[model samples]
Target: MNSNNSVFGQTLAQVHSKFIIVQVLVVIFLCVNLLLIVTFFKNECFYTTTRYILFAVTLLSDSFLFLASDFIFIFNIFRVTMQVSLCSVSCIIVGLYLIVTPVTLTAMTLERYVAICMPLRHAELCSTHSSVHVILVIHGLSSVPYAVIFITFFASASLDFYYQYRTCSVEIFFLYKWQDHVKSAVFQFYFLIMCLIIMLCYFKIMKVARTASGDDKISSRKGLRTVTLHAFQLLLCLIQFWYPLITSSLIHIDFTDLQHVRFFCYIMFNLAPRCLSPLIYGLRDEMFLHALRRCLSCGLYETK
Candidate 1:
């Protein structure tokens, strides 16, 4: 596959370089994520709130997604052909991430909504244990559709040849035409429903926030800013990924011709949330940052 550009019909040197850059970024992201995890676990305060728990969950899920999907970059960097079993497992992991992420995000938004709009009910509705339960339930429920797709896939696909391109989607290369339709429809429908839930929750949150006045006003404004940031992140996901993903059916570009497009989209959409979630969501809390600083400083002094 590393020979002349006959198969892909384009110069692959640039593509190979891009893969290296992305993999380097992924390594950096993994390190920072690990640091935050260790810091959070040490502090009792971090686990006390539902929001923090949800933020931690998002960070963990996003990290796993990057690790699962971007192994292709490593293989591509070495100019190695991926093994069939590894490729199949990679496909399943990536699909699971795609479903799990939006659902978790939806839960995050709802948590924020209740915390802001319905402060009295927030404690009851959004507890650490309940948040963890919701995460488990979301993962469990979303697995059903993907489960059906995966079972049907193995039964139908010949699996004699696996894709050499950066795209690891099994739906595109394997499975019957109708099965592909079922897969895409499941993703789109779930995303649409979850997207609506997020927007509605935030909309109600913003309205309630603006109506507050006096001393409560300051807290409301902070909530407004935080919720807006969440919305912005979702908007980024929509533009970078969901829009292209939805419109993917419109143009039928061959994978080889559009490898660069898919490559960058995966970076921006798939990997970016993992990279940014810790900073944007987790570290935004002043308490978490202070705890992290103290932990690092204590460790530094001990090392000295």
Candidate 2:
């Protein structure tokens, strides 16, 4: 009995530690995202430009994702159960942002491809008006997958399911075993298409870089690196979707060991991907960094 008590205490401490760590990371990223967003609004050039506009949308999606996921994480840590209806709302919001992030990343990559590979048509193809249409299309596409899942939920779930209190998770949508397989297959196909598009953009940009000179060459090379970062970010997002398969393979392991693996994967795949937007855009892009620095300096001067 004494040994069991000691083990329980240790597990409690670990849970507290994990909570604190997650909160700290979320706060840091949210603060950074807010600062970059402010800088984007302060500069007319950034707000008007197609590339920066897409970057801003990516940041906005990341911000919303961080908030929604963090809410779920905290609830799960405390083992709080809510009505299925409430949980469904939170889960749906999280799902939308998750879908939006990768789609926006793909759009950003295509924007770069046009800017470098078709310089003469870049303005006409990627104009501010066109970007608004692109964003609408992205959100529209992101909504379709969730709409199908919600339809399944409503069709399969009895009325009692809505009033029942349960811990929120993606699993709530899986009203039947077949739904899980369908979800997995749909995601697999979606990601395969996205992966192909990014790869194609990279190869096209590479060709442009090889034969180009001076400013055009430099632009194409930078675009290549940017697309590579997008691909890496997409891979991280993809892993979260496949997380169930990863954990299922470890089912034979001790329960505690399995929990530890899940925690690590949550941090690495879920939290880490949301943190990369600032690194890819705010710090890596020379123009944006310059604008951000100038905005910060001006703010500091005004404060003084």
Find the candidate with the highest TM-score and give its number.
Answer: 2
Q: Candidate 2 clashing pairs?
A: none
lDDT of 2 by residue, 1-304 (tens): 9999999999999999999998999999899999999999988887668889988998899899889989998888878988999888998898888889888988898998888888899989988899899999999988776777788888999998899988788777787978777777777777888889999999999999999999888878888999999999988987776775776589799978977897898789877987888999999988888878878898674455
lDDT of 1 at 193: 79
TM-score of 1: 0.83
Q: Global lDDT of each model?
A: 0.69, 0.86
Per-structure clash totals for the candidates: 0, 0
Tell how far residue 267 is off in model 1, in angstroms.
1.5
Model 1 stretches with alpha carbons more than 4 Å out: 1-12, 76-79, 158-168, 238-256, 299-304
Q: What TM-scores do the predictions have? A: 0.83, 0.95
Point out the worst 10-residue segment of candidate 1 by lDDT: 162-171
